[model samples]
Target: MGVFLETSRLVLRPFGAGDVDLLVALDGDPAVMRFINGGRPTSREAVEARVLPRLLRDYPWGTRGYWAAEEKGGGGFLGWFEFRPVEAENPAVVELGYRLNRSAWGRGYATEGSRALIHKGFTDLGVERVTANTMAVNTGSRRVMEKSGLTLVRHFTGDWPERIEGSEHGEVEYALTRSRWERTRQPPAAPRP
Candidate 1:
């Protein structure tokens, strides 16, 4: 009984306790979790004890949280998308991210889900900006970020615990401000402001 946002091929909906199975299945896929965990599987206990709790905690801060993305026609769970604020001190901003089953790749679900979330941020959530980050070698995610209208903000290097292959060149952040999003949403430009 939560609200759902529908794109042409996917639907984004609120998370529920019943989603543990879906999370396990998604995290179990070696191909899906390759870059994230070096193909290691995530245990259900870890997801239940730590991941889900942290994911849902953002609800109190803002209208930003993870969502379950499903195929509109079949109702199959593709994966999840996150539109949550990066909880930190001082001014904060929302971040966009997604994780899909291997079957969901090359199907445009990432782009569709991301675009819907970006629009929801600016229009419904009053978010002034949205950003996304991925490993520098993560071309697929970077592509989704750019296709969703975010420009490269910076490249960040972190001491990742897993140390995947692409972690070397560092991670990149992409962002889109409200004004930039508004411009992309418009039909045609009349004149400069």
Candidate 2:
């Protein structure tokens, strides 16, 4: 499969037909799925029927929204990242998301990949804004968003079908705009004499 993006230690590639097992393994971890589904495992049937199809679908902007993340040197499947447009015909605003195996947590992969995607969106993908959301108590994910140059935009209650552990506190949205991002980008260093 063609690589969508690459960082120093990760390779983001398009999902393939043979990646069902990887998805199954990733969603099968209770610790990883805690905030998503109250520690429930996603059935393989659901992965094949719904999850994989959504990942495989191409957006109207001519790109895949989800990418399978892997370690640089054959370290194997870690999980996935999402950088999809909010509107089907407009690439101006996009949402960012990530889900990694328990083994990959605390390794900075989330922040690294998010930063790269934000940079790409702003520079090459005609994106004007990037946004992300997580359960209010998800401090780890919040930190990743902050590290990726996003700021808290709002806190609102989502109408989830089932209440997760932290649902009582609602959810938080973080965002970064192109103008803000450009202002924060480091200027080129002066040439030496």
Candidate 3:
């Protein structure tokens, strides 16, 4: 598959079968998986059987649900991003998500990629709404969602199979609707005289 989207510094491309090692290495980092699975390192067997299958699946609209994020200049795998519909058959509402290596953190990559994906969702993908969720304690993720123009929609506990460190505090949902996005979009600057 070809590149799904691109920002000035990142390229989002569809994942391939050859990308298993990248996923394994990414999920092996404890800090990266802290909130995801309480720092448990995922086995290659799991990634091959469970994780990769989900990422490689195509949606009803003919687009893959997940994309591998890479640095534009270096072409290094950063992580993956999710922009799949909430319902399998509907394209109206899609879930937005990302999982980047710790080295990619604090560099504004998350915010940059997120804003671009949200823009693509509303402007080109016929998406009516974009939603994201993270543990309430994850202030960094929350900030990225806010920076991408999503606002807090709800806070609720999820029925996860396993409890993590911050599960007690619950989770939060942030969202932006196409109408709100249109109203808040900044117009292009006027040409200088």
Best-performing candidate as measured by lDDT:
3
Off-target runs (Cα >4 Å) in candidate 1 are: 58-64, 88-92, 186-193
Candidate 3 pairs with clashing backbones = none
Give the higher-lDDT candidate: 1 or 3.
Answer: 3
What tens-digit string does per-residue lDDT give for candidate 2 at 34-71? 88988899999999999999999787668899999999
- Which of candidates 2 and 3 is the stronger one according to lDDT? 3
Compared with the true structure, all predictions reach lDDT values of 0.79, 0.90, 0.90
lDDT for each residue of candidate 1 in 1-193, tens digit (9 for 90 to 100): 4656877678777777788888889998888887787888999999898777765554544443888899887779999998887654312378899999888887778887888888877887767889888888889999988878889999889879868776788989999999988877732112123
Worst 10 residues of 1 by lDDT: 184-193
Instruction: Give the TM-score comparing model 2 with the true structure, all chains together.
Output: 0.94
* Ranking 1 against 2 by lDDT, winner: 2
RMSD of each: 5.2, 4.3, 3.6
How well does each candidate superpose onto the true structure, as a TM-score?
Answer: 0.88, 0.94, 0.94
